[model samples]
Target: MNETTLPPDDFHCGYVALIGAPNAGKSTLMNALLGAKISIVTAKPQTTRKRVLGFYTGDTHQIIFIDTPGLIRPKYILQQSMVTAAHSAIAEADAICVLIDGARALERGDLLPVGLLDLLRKAGSPVFAVITKSDLVADKKQLLPMMARLLEFYDFKAVIPISAPEGQGLDGLIDELRAVLPVGPQLYPEDMLSDAPERFFVSEIIREKIFEQYRQEVPYATEVFIAEFREEEKCDHIAAEIIVERESQKRILIGSGGDALKAIGIAARKDIEAFLGRKVFLELHVRVRDGWRDNEAWVRRLGY
Candidate 1:
């Protein structure tokens, strides 16, 4: 008797890295593409501190979108490392998406320090210049000059404008991505959305909550470390410590009667539960790291 076997999964897979300046909505774009909050988004510069991977699967394509930290000047060691991570993503990607906020234009003082055009030229990757926040800019006339100026930077393989918030031009962006993806086996399973482990997600969730609650430099000065994560059938309990520079900052983070900490915990737990699809018990604590952001050792230990 002859038996017929199923055909192999001939999926198109490739890595596409998103690079942009701070507050360029790269995280929002990634979340929108994945149809989930795979990466946290807030109305603050430098909200994302590490490289986040988001997966997009279609009938015949699996595009792994790497959401990197917004590029900026490196004032601290941590910031330098974050910038390095973004550049590494650019080098490793099968394709590159250079995201620019449409509402903002390059000015005399405003510049992308790494010389993105040159970097792209060196990497030799097919780059898509994506102007995000299309919904904000109403008049196309206002954007035309900006687009033209962008063209002067480099000859992009494709230039597309998208509103990640309103989900505009996403299909076209996806189609453009599909056209550029090399034919290969799937890099990740259809069900997987990120390359990070649960512990990393736990820390990020807590950090996101902290960013939402704090103002000024508090959020920027803060880092979340998952000291311990214990999983139970009933609940996945996480013990995380928020590292800060000074005792005053620590007090502020803790808040009166731990109200601020409670707020952060409550918010983080809710997001964590949604992310893991299970109950989450979150414990938060504040510690003084004495300018840990500039400390290379601390940055590595915190997994910058």
Candidate 2:
């Protein structure tokens, strides 16, 4: 009798890192690709400060998308950590997707993602390009020039143009991604969406509500921490501390007669309820942590 050799499995699995400049819609792209809001989104730049993984399973491939903070020049220690988180993801990813703002690139006549090609080259990961927020582009002809300029960035495998919110080019984006992934076993189960702790997103949801509540300097000065997250039979109880660097900002967060805090708590509680699929009783408080963003100790303590 002759010995028989078995063929290797053809199933694919890999990490895909989304890299871009501030507010370039990397989070939006990840949510769209997963068909779920695993990554938070906001108008504020650098809203994402950590690495979040969104897992997706298809017929033959399982892709783990790593949503990292938008890469930026770090003026503060917090921002340095944020940029570091994004860079770390790229180093571990098997494929790198460079997301660029189509509107901004068209307006400036410059493709901002070209700088990322150097990092991608250094990582030795196969890179592709995507022009995000395509729906915002009024003139169709404008995209041609933007896409043409991306050639200067590198000879990308495929440069896709996508509108994440409007459901355009998403399937094609997935197909493009599937081609670059490695043949391996799925790392996560099919039913799982993310690997982050519940408190991480609880803090993030509260942080999002803060951004929605304030403007200008307030958002930049604010961060949230979930001091206690407890579960009851009928409802979840969450207490979040809003951290600011100044007493004046703390007063601004609390509002006169505590009315502003009430509003923020109300909005955040509703979002948290929806997110957890349970009734939530949320508590909010404000504290002053001077220059927390510049202090690595507080930055790590605050869960960044």
TM-score of each: 0.93, 0.95
Question: How much is 128 displaced in model 1, in angstroms?
Answer: 0.9
Q: Give the TM-score of candidate 1.
A: 0.93
Which candidate leads in TM-score? 2
Per-residue lDDT for 1-304 in model 1, tens only?
0135332345568999999998888999999999988898899889988899999988888899999999887898999999998999999999999988887753332424367777888899889888888888878667677777767778888778899878998999998898888887666667888888988888888888889899998898999889888989899878899999999999899899989999998899988998889998787878899999999899998877
lDDT of 1 at 29: 93
Candidate 1 has which clashing residue pairs, if any?
none
Residue 136 shift from truth in candidate 2, angstroms: 0.8
Candidate lDDT values, in order:
0.85, 0.86
Q: Alpha-carbon error at 226 in model 2, in Å?
A: 0.9
